[model samples]
Target: MQADIYKENGFFLDEWQLLEDEQALPTEPGRFLVSLERFVAAPEAFASLPEIAILVRAGDDVTVLAPHLDRFTMVAIEFAAFSDGRGYSSARLLRQRLCYHGELRAVGDVLLDQIPLMRRCGFDAFKVVHEPTRRALETGHLAEVPLYLQPAARPDEQPAGARAWARSPAGLAR
Candidate 1:
């Protein structure tokens, strides 16, 4: 699992493994990933475990984590399907709106092409189960357009023509 998890520093083991169902909590004693509903229901149940954070699924209200942001070490947004872009908005809200400063992770159905967009949206870590993505990330072989047309949490320079919407990578005068 370590090699599959990608971060800015490099791949690392998922210290707090993700749990799909709350019913499976009994088997996982220490730190683990919990659902939005389960964690919001009774956060005190896991008050002692700092590593136990919530995994918000697509369409789930991320505002619920606002009050409990201080208690979490990480927040993982699930992308059940790669085509579902709901997780991207969720990540944006967590970072830009709520101002969460913890480790924001992108989990489930993460692909090679989505990594750059994910980082721009404020995802610091990614759970890449796709082999091609892992290989590309491990080899530093990625194809991404450094220019952007929309604003994001990660700051970018002006692309060209002074167009407010367009942005180029930092240090590159476009």
Candidate 2:
């Protein structure tokens, strides 16, 4: 089944070819996404695979994947359920702490209501399966509030002026 792909620009594009669960890893180098377990089990095999991406589950530690970040062209965080929000923190850490500059995507259980927050958390792409969510994304039906209370991982985004503490030095008085 083909999913609707949303990029940071809020445009729908089908450039990526998702690897199905039943499909085996391609022998030739090409763009592909693999499960975290499969990639961890045999990191060397994927090391040489060009344009490789990995699917990280909510519980998986981002630190373990840090060393191999340079090898991946993208890192997709899996959201098993809409209630599972651990993926948000993972994306933030990958962007703010690990400094992963590649594509950060949200896969599985992606909904229209969550796209705005997901982008703030540093997800640049989304693989949404629901038709309503896809339409909402395509038509700009998302009721996004541009104001942010806290500073986001993206350096270009400044914190809201209301939160003076965000801009002040840790030990300095506002």
Q: Which residue runs of candidate 2 sit more than 4 Å off their true CA positions? A: 1-3, 9-24, 161-174
Clashing pairs in model 2, backbone N/Cα/C closer than 3 A: none
lDDT of 2 by residue, 1-174 (tens): 454678857656555556765677788756888877777777886656678888889899887787889988889999999999999999998998999999998999999889888988999998888899978877878768668775777778767644776557872653
Winning model by TM-score: 1
Instruction: Kindly report which residue stretches of model 1 are placed more than 4 angstroms away from their true locations once superposed.
Output: 19-29, 156-174
Candidate 1 lDDT over 1-174, as tens digits, reads 246778877788887866666364544357788889888888777765647778999999999888888878889999999899999999999998999999999999999989888888899999988998888888998668667766667656453434543344543555
Angstrom error at residue 65, model 2:
1.3
Mind sharing the TM-score for model 1? 0.83
Cα-based TM-score, every candidate: 0.83, 0.81
Please give the CA lDDT of all the candidate structures. Answer: 0.82, 0.82
